[model samples]
Target: MMSRLRITEIFYSLQGEARSVGWPTVFIRLTGCPLRCSYCDTTYAFQGGEWLSLDEILRQVASYDCRHVCVTGGEPLAQKACAELLTKLCDAGYAVSLETSGALDISVADTRVSRVMDLKTPSSGEVSKNDYTNIEHLQEQDQVKFVIADRADYDWSCAQVSEHDLTSRCEVLYSPVQGKLAPRQLADWILADHLPVRMQVQMHKLLWGDKPGH
Candidate 1:
């Protein structure tokens, strides 16, 4: 028999971030993570969760009758079976996206699923854990995100964008860490510097729900 995945929760909400932002999407929150990113909001998923089989997961997802699905986690890629799940979701015909920290190999994920990967910023404390090799795997449908918490993080992210030519590889996202960096300030920097990236403020702008999930 195949292994059951540890699931923190599954719920429906408008996607709070990324290109699929504002889409009514089912979020599959997998349990566990390896890195301790300082600004993580989903620390609740780090510990206890219920184990769920993929078939049951699909059944619950279909119950929602939504066309979009986002498989997220404390770190979704932390679970090896996540790839299998992604493929199953895609095969089932739901438009799927995977939100992951750029600390693991992304090549294993199904090509049909869009990947929204994060490159840890200095303030995240997991910057050094970033696997630069993953850059080469990014496709046009994919995205690279940098969660900025300070001016230093912004500057460092710009350098990474320039050094890697990230915009040409895929869409680059610059998101402010709520309460740490002001959204307007980040927007100004992007404009003044002429940074080729998308500036997203999910809570301030995109979120129709009271709070973000996963």
Candidate 2:
């Protein structure tokens, strides 16, 4: 029922690291977060942003004329209005996805939006904030991402994948933290274990190289 949200940016870009990777998508980045991961890329979004009503947001998104829309954050769910925003976006007929940190409860999200949930690994420095209960809410349309920074993080992710049967529940993603763990190392680990998960690199980061508003 909320009418407005704090928004960092709304832009058109390629789907970065999810199943929709490389597809042209419209990204709506909401402002604020409660957890700070070690390899956090959008620290600039943690603060100051423009506050716009839901209608205004829809106008911008519609301007892009793209069918794929991603609602991301500095933790988009941190804002009470985000759920309403997501629901409205879906109502507007876009194929909407939410990129959220695992710390928040996703029970309130509109079912129409696909969720790309990031499960914080040990090296993220906010592992304790992960709400493992969120696993029960995931459907095959959703995805779980583990950004690994080292061997320990990789092991922890592999264990979680097995313990929860994450691959069967939804798409399981493993991405190496930029500059921390090499893609080849993570790929080798997945290959050795025969882990049923997808490996990906951030296509936007590759194209833009850490620049904001990509």
Candidate 3:
């Protein structure tokens, strides 16, 4: 029997966030997340999705004819077969990336796949789920993202950056929650402190506004 994964949806669109942002990419959003972040946007992926075998998944991705592929979730790592999927994508020669909640063990991922892990902020209400141990495993190509929703979250995020010396290990990304925090305010705070992390907004959201498949 072939390995199968619970897939939420798979579509071709511009990479929305992370290092690959703005590039035309294929998104493989998996089903089921263990944590419920307060500002979750892809809540639709929490449950109810179709299951596809590895061959079928790769076939659809090939049909897209794009070079960049992002394996994201409702915590894609929640599925045992997700690691295999990442490895298969890499073996197929796609510039693959994985968008995962930092709550899970990222060590299981393929080294070739860029890991875009998130550190849930205080405002997200699920900050406790962060597995800080994953930081040590970060490759230079990996990224750590902080989804800021308020001043408290921003300050806490800065503290994590300092405490972990994250910049020295990998690229750090600072993103403001869609409405709770103004993009300009987050930008000003980063400038005021001269934070080295890259600031990014949800480009897809700005273009498509919560529309799935992008």
Candidate 3 lDDT tens digits, 151-186: 999999999999999999999999999989999999
lDDT of each candidate versus the true structure: 0.92, 0.92, 0.95
Q: Taking the tens digit of each residue's C-alpha lDDT, what string does model 1 give over 10-105?
A: 998778889998788999999999999998988888989998999989999999999999999989999999999999999999999999999999
Q: What does candidate 1 score in Cα RMSD to the true structure? A: 1.7
**What TM-score does candidate 1 get on C-alpha atoms?**
0.96
lDDT, model 3: 0.95
Residue pairs with colliding backbones in model 2 are none
Point out the higher-scoring one by TM-score: 2 or 3. 3
TM-score of each: 0.96, 0.98, 0.99
Q: Model 2: runs farther than 4 Å from truth?
A: none
For residues 14-94, write the lDDT of model 2, one tens digit per residue: 998888898899999999999989899999999999999999999999999899999998999999889998999889899
Q: Predictions ranked by TM-score, top down?
A: 3, 2, 1
For candidate 2, the per-residue lDDT at 151 reads: 98
Off by over 4 Å in 1: 204-214
